[model samples]
Target: MLAKSIDRLPPPRAGGWRYEPKFDGYRALATIQTDSSVQVHSRRGTPLDDAFPELVGALYAYLPAGTVVDGEIVCWAGGRLDFNRLQRRYAQRRHARELAVTQPVHLVVFDVLETAQDGDLRRRPLRERRAVLERLFRRIPARSPLTLAMQTSDPAVAEEWFDTMAVAGVEGLVIKPANSPYVCGARVWLKYKSRQTTDAVVGGVTGSLHRPAALLLGRYGSDTGRLHYAGRTTHLSDAQAAAVAPLLVAAIGGHPWPVRLTVN
Candidate 1:
């Protein structure tokens, strides 16, 4: 199921609402075949088995055949979910096993879409589906890559996660109706992300150094104080470009950044 973007979280008075931490990772749907083989793919139908062979191996060992699950593939590092490391894991698919040993990934299973006995559970209400999911997790070891995601109906607990989970790189909260059924590709659930303001350094500009069109922003790493590309600014006004151009100082020796950096 997909979540619709919402400006704010559900009100405290909202009834029958369930809250989950919006994870900072890749959304994946996985299925276990009758022979205990597993197939995993992203929402866009891209194959993910190569990127996370360890996850597939763990799922094959834990889940029963004819089971389908919906979740995110997340990598935890430095006591938090590191999105950069997750990207690296995906990029280094040829050396996935080595990466897994250094920075293992987890499958945060949230919803049980199907089971061995029940062919399909997407039409069932979430409350019942959650019960089935819990039962399945009972036999799986805690250290397994597949883990049940955290869900709570209490608004206070949800608020606590919303306020604090961001430090661990959690995107935000996803709110769903307790009795709502899974609707594929539908924006039935609501998502709210916490907004924060911060400072960034102007590493470079696009278009030209003299007549820049947009700003390339960077932030100094906390440990090394080395500038890392954070993001780019939106299109600049003529006056904004003209005023900022003079501040652009050329890198004396070899620049820290590469000549060609992937924009996205």
Candidate 2:
């Protein structure tokens, strides 16, 4: 099931809700056949076995046959999860083995879709499925490149994790009803992310005065005190463009961004 994005976390209600960390990585489903062969599928159903050969091999070795799990493939860099590094690893066709050694990946399993004992667990309640997933993790060897993601029912605990774990690469929190089943293609889960606003200098624009495209943003560095490219905003409406035009004075000497470009 996919999660629907929300601006803020909702207050807990009478019924129970399970909160789990939302990872900033590729969403993948790992399937272990009856013969112990492993296959990894992306969220778009693209086969990812070749992209992450080591993870596929490890799943085959560690997980029981006929197991199907949902998780994220994450790579760590500079003491935090690096989505850019993961993207680069995903794009590699050759020299994957060498890159695997230098940039090892880990699969953080969150839910189990199938098991050897029970063919399909999607109909089971989330709490029940989580219990089974926890039991399965206990059987994995200590050195396996797999991790059972943490979950909690307490909103306070979820809030704490959202705040504290951000530095450790946790993106946000995903909340779901405890008794709800895993409805495929359903948006039953709620996502909460922390947002903060800061001041940035407007650098440039795309369209003319009548129809401004976007506002090029920049920030002054603390050490150098020079404007640096931050990012760009979405297209502005006609009224917004008119309001912002008077404030954007042409550069007297030189602009921060010399050439037209997008930062990200």
Candidate 3:
């Protein structure tokens, strides 16, 4: 299941909704066969066992056979989820074993897709599925790499988590209806991410004077004191583009970005 990005979190109603931390890591699905063999798949359906051997071993050792789980694979570094470290493991296969021992990845399980006895749980309500997931976690031995993602129904509590838990590598919060069934490939779930605005210097522009394109942005580094490329904004309206054209004359001397602006 996937979540649709929303500008804001919906207000809590009498009917109920579940909120959970959105982890910043690779979205992975783990399937444990009846013979205790484990296979992990990435969001794009690529095999992940080769890059995440530790996770495969832990799932095979702890979770019972015929278990299918939906979760995120995250690497913790300096008390936060380090995506760069995880990407390094994925790209550099030769040193994966050493990195697995030193950095150790964790599978933050959020949903149970299937169980050994009950079979597929996607049709079950989220409340019921969560209960089963919690019970499954309780059966795991101590110090296992598998972790159950925290959840709550209170929007206030969810906001507090969003505000405070970002330091712990929480990307945002996922909101789902309590009684809704898990709809695969459906945008039933909503995601809320904290956002803030910052000022960036306009380095260049695309398009012509009559119709302006995006604004190439830059920012001055505090240590380097140099204008570094930040990013580009979306296309501008014709009127807005014409209004800003007079202000964006080409620099006579050396500019921060010397390359030509290519519009796409």
Candidate 4:
């Protein structure tokens, strides 16, 4: 099945519809045509065939040639999705063997991009796509490498998963408009980042020597007027970070360094 692209932020359907927890992981696009040839692409439209051989093999075995799927590639470790580990395997030289031993890849399929003999379904409603998805999932084997993305209409359940992930050191939660059509290259999907609350001193800012952007974060210090290397927060504007940095430096005067706290 060849998946077609759609706008991400389409209006919701009237009957209301299904809802699924968005995973904080790599957005993967899998395409397997009738000839059994398989292609995997990242959200950025980059090819990822060489990085994950086991995943490719799994897709080849379970999905019919020309089956196209839209999903997230995730690696779960110690009750959390280990994105760092997933990234590591992508760069490993012996990824196949290493992935088998270390962090294994799993496809959390959520949408059916293409359906057999039906022609392009990109512009169709999500319910239509989901019908194809449900049918396609019934045939494929459910195992580690290939599995359906968990779905729940209950806000409580979704909230629980979000809390569990946050406590477990996972990235964050993704919330998608259930009946909304798939949109390519748009922020139609909403992402809620896991905020790590910490107090730190304002650092310095610098203009982008090469680009138009500016930096807005710096290290932390103690009341004793000591300088400590705290993490940077680029969340502020260049003007904001630059404005407060000087005052912060002078307010503390000259003091000795204190203990530091490092977050994962």
The prediction achieving the highest lDDT against the true structure is: 1
Candidate 2: RMSD over Cα atoms? Answer: 3.2
lDDT of 4 by residue, 1-264 (tens): 222223232244454545455555678899987888889999778987778777788888877766788898888888877888888877783556666556678888988767566667776766688777777778777564888866655556766776676766555555555566766665655555556676555343333322223333334444756545555545556576556544543224533333233432
User: Residues 2-112, candidate 2, lDDT per residue (tens digit)?
Assistant: 999898888766569999999999999999999888899999999988888889888988789999999999988999999999999998937678887888888999999
**For this target, which candidate reaches the highest TM-score against the unseen true structure?**
2
**Comparing 2 and 3 by TM-score, which wins?**
2
Each candidate structure's TM-score, on Cα atoms with residue i matched to residue i, is 0.79, 0.86, 0.84, 0.73
Task: Give the Cα error of residue 161 in candidate 1, in Å.
Answer: 0.8
Pairing residues by index, what is the TM-score of model 2?
A: 0.86
- Cα error, residue 132 of model 1, in Å, equals 0.8
Report the lDDT tens digits of candidate 3 across residue range 152-230: 9988999899999888878899999998888878988999987657999878777753356878888999998989888
Residue 242 in model 3: shift from native, Å? Answer: 13
Supply the TM-score for candidate 4: 0.73
State each model's CA lDDT, in order.
0.90, 0.87, 0.87, 0.65
Of models 3 and 4, which has the larger TM-score? Answer: 3
Which ten contiguous residues of candidate 4 have the minimum total lDDT? 1-10
Clashes of each: 0, 0, 0, 10
Each candidate: RMSD to true structure? 5.6, 3.2, 4.2, 5.9
List of clashing residue pairs for candidate 2: none
Tell how far residue 179 is off in model 2, in angstroms.
0.7
Q: Over the stretch 211-262, how does candidate 1's per-residue lDDT look in tens digits?
A: 9999888999999989899999899999999998898876777766787777
Instruction: Give me the runs in candidate 4 sitting further than 4 Å from their true place.
Output: 1-18, 169-172, 203-228, 234-264
Model 1 lDDT, residue 264, Cα: 66
| Clash pairs detected, candidate 3 | none
